[model samples]
Target: MTERVLVAYASKNGSTAGIATMIAEALREQGLAAEARAVGEVESVGPYDAVVLGGALYAGRWRREAVRFAWHHEADLTERPVWLFSSGPLDATAREGLIPPVPGVQRLVDRLKARGHVTFGGCLQDGAKGRIARMIVKSGRGGDFRDPEQIRLWARGVARELVKEVATP
Candidate 1:
């Protein structure tokens, strides 16, 4: 049977959503059934065989809706395969310096026994922010830092792992 995967995300300016969509596409390319949906729009994870949950970070915290979804779906998520990701660092090197996952997210990851947690570079748009915010980003961090190839590579790895899991036992 084909595994059904859910790629759900919470994004402020749509970057994380785009990443989630890319992941879902990559999984589909690998021949798995996958769907991408906003965290707020997902009412249940009951139907999915695996889940990829992600959110944008701000002030060192994931978006509230992502956190809430994890909390509300704790049991269902714990019974399925789960992977987590945070998309926020503006540069590749910046990803290496990210603080540990927030306690709530970490706790959920533990409960879900998630397969992995990845941090990916994020995009910053000059026009989306106020002048001061734009100035801060322009100081050195403004750009579309997301690498589609990297994202696709990670998604393919995930697809391989899921295939292996299904084959086992």
Candidate 2:
């Protein structure tokens, strides 16, 4: 059977969700069965052969929902192939180089034994939720920094790894 992959995310302002969707689409193009879903909406990870979990960043920290999901499904995630991603950094740095996971997320990566991790640029645009977000937008600091091509490329790399793993076994 084709690998069943789950591209799950914890997004606060919809940017991370968009990245997760791109990932799932790329995996499908690579002939794997993949779907993107919110971490809170998923009850179990047992159905997936592999997982790509992502979170948005705030104040140099991974979103709380993402952290909670990782720990909550620690047992199941460790038993399968897992990749982690973070979508933040409102700049081009993510596409330019590898941005290491934050301390909290690094702990999750270590505990889960995730196969790999990547950090992507984030988006903060008008009408974003939260007072802080509004302030950023008002201060002219909020803008969409997400690059779809970069996200797709990363997802394709992830697909290659997953395909290789499944083919080996």
Candidate 3:
């Protein structure tokens, strides 16, 4: 039987959304029916057999909307299989170890009992935002920090897990 998966993301500058879309496509390739939607647009999680929530990190935090989405649906989410990912660490080597989420994000994680959280390197666009955002991007290396191969590998693992779940019962 095929499993239904929802890939939800909150993105600024489109980095996280791009990652979510690729992941959804990869899951489809693995024979799962998956859809990628923005966090705001998802009205209900009742239809999905599995959920993948992801967002871009800014100032070392996941986006506010993403956190709230998890919070709002915590009970439903906790009862189902869920995975989480974050596009973070603009600096290539900053994610060498397990970096715990800050207090706010920790609460979000606890609510869903998220199976796993992976931090991928994000991107910075030149002159895309106002003074402060521009300054932040310029202060860091301004380019796409995302590794497509790593993203694909991780999505494959998640898809496999979903398949395994379907096979179990």
Candidate 4:
């Protein structure tokens, strides 16, 4: 059976959501059935054979909705193939300094045996920030650091993994 994959994300400013959409599209292109949805809108993981959960990182943490979604669907996620991703790190060097998922997320990943946790560069647009974020941007720590090629490459890897899983059993 073809695996149905859910690409669910929690995005603050739509950057992560864009990534999720791209991933879903790439998966579809790879012949898997995939759909992208906001974590807040996903009612259940029961309908999907696999999941790709992503969140926008802020202050070393993931959005609350994404974290809660993982916790709420822990059992199902543990049984299915799951992947996790975080999008944030406005600094060009942020990828080099990528931090592991926060403790809570790591615990869930451990329990679920998630396939992987990838961190991609993020974008910071003009006038899209709150005061603090604006300050951070003004401090020369911001730009559109997102790399389309990198994101596409990661999605292709995910597609390959899903294909392997379908062929395994």
lDDT of every predicted structure (CA atoms): 0.85, 0.91, 0.83, 0.85
Candidate 1 off by > 4 Å: 94-104, 129-135, 138-140
Q: Give candidate 2 misplaced runs (Cα > 4 Å).
A: none
Best by TM-score: 2
Which regions of candidate 3 are displaced past 4 Å? 94-99
Name the runs in model 4 displaced over 4 angstroms.
Answer: 94-99, 138-140
How well is each residue in 1-169 modelled by candidate 1, as lDDT tens digits?
8999999999977789999999999999999999999998898899999999999877677888988888899899989889998887776753445446666668767888998887788887766555644775778667777878888988999999999999998
Model 4, range 11-75, lDDT digits (tens) per residue?
Answer: 97788998899899888988989999999898999999899999888888888999889889988
lDDT of 3 at 36: 94
lDDT of 4: 0.85
Per-residue alpha-carbon lDDT of model 3 for 44-147, expressed as tens digits?
Answer: 89999999999888877899899889988888898888998888677675345555666666667777898887787777787555575678777875668787
Model 3's lDDT to the true fold? 0.83
- Our tally of clashes for model 3 stands at 0
Across 1-169, the per-residue lDDT of candidate 2 in tens digits comes to 7999999999989999999998999889989999999999999999999999999999999989999999899999999999999988887889788888999988888999998899999999988999988898889988888888888888898889888987885
TM-score of candidate 4 against the unseen true structure: 0.89
Candidate 3 clash pair list: none
| TM values, all candidates | 0.89, 0.97, 0.90, 0.89
Provide the global lDDT of candidate 2 against the true structure: 0.91
